[model samples]
Target: MRKFLASIAVSLLITGCTFPGVHKIDIPQGNVVTQEMVDQLKPGMTRNQVRYIMGTPLVTDTFSPDRWDYIYSQQKGGEERTQKNLSLFFSDNSLQRISGDYRPGGAAQ
Candidate 1:
């Protein structure tokens, strides 16, 4: 009985000392827009022109037909996640304004 208990305790101790490794999968979501693509955008560009330049937007609202949102986010393992957002507003089916994390010509407005 003593030997059996000792064996059990040793097994338990060994198992307790072992830890399962954690593997974090990279998570990426939304459209991936680059500075060059953003640089191509300009006021008065048509909706199709913007789409051709920046690809499809990540978020589009039915209620807000005049506004389009481009969002990008990614996370890798234990590293800090990064996100970018670009919003375009249209008036009469033409690009009127741009806003969000990225700005054109270093200007926010």
Candidate 2:
């Protein structure tokens, strides 16, 4: 009887390990950029103005001080990650153009 109980307990533990009982919560990272925010951008806008509208960028490269990258990504539990990327190019410390997964206003949508 003791042998039978020990075997049963071991089997339960093994089964539990194989089962997907663990919950993986959604994970989100990086700055969130929106179309409306991009629309607020205008040509020749200063860096401060662009930052005010688009918030701080996710990456600022020292090699390319004229460029700023805004990236956002999310993983829903066990699913694949979805990502969005936007880049702001500056000329003479002023915003020149914007490009990425989204377009300003209804340009793409």
Candidate 3:
């Protein structure tokens, strides 16, 4: 009887989540890179300074030591997932350029 009751309860919990009215909260993951943060970066800034302004990068490759990738993704309750990418390049421990969806001087692309 206990096993039967447990199975019934489990089924009800699963079905409850499948109900149409069930609400799903927005899910955001990874580095939340922002336009203002990217704009704060300037050529010739040291790697530590860049890290301070932009927060930690989401991706850093050992093979490509000079390149740092910042990635952001969001999934709304019932909508398709969206993503943004930012790549910052450094040479000689100083920032050299920026690339990807975000750029300085304006809103994200």
Tell me how far the alpha carbon of residue 7 in candidate 2 is from the true structure, in angstroms, after superposition.
7.4
- Estimated TM-score per prediction? 0.73, 0.77, 0.82
lDDT (tens digit, per residue) of candidate 1 on 1-109:
9999999999988876354665767998899887778888899999999999998888899999899999899998756999989999999999999999887765433
> TM-score of the candidate numbered 2?
0.77
Tell me which residue pairs clash in candidate 2: none
Per-model RMSD to reference: 5.5, 3.2, 3.4
Q: Compared with the true structure, what per-residue lDDT tens digits does model 3 show for residues 13-69?
A: 889877888898999999998788877888999999999998889899999999999
- Consecutive 10-residue window with the lowest summed lDDT within model 3: 100-109
Among the numbered candidates, top lDDT falls to: 3
The predicted structure with the larger lDDT, 1 or 2, is 2
Off by over 4 Å in 1: 1-23, 106-109
Q: In candidate 3, which residue pairs clash?
A: none
Q: Model 1, residue 38: displacement in angstroms?
A: 0.4
Leading candidate by TM-score: 3
TM-score of model number 3: 0.82
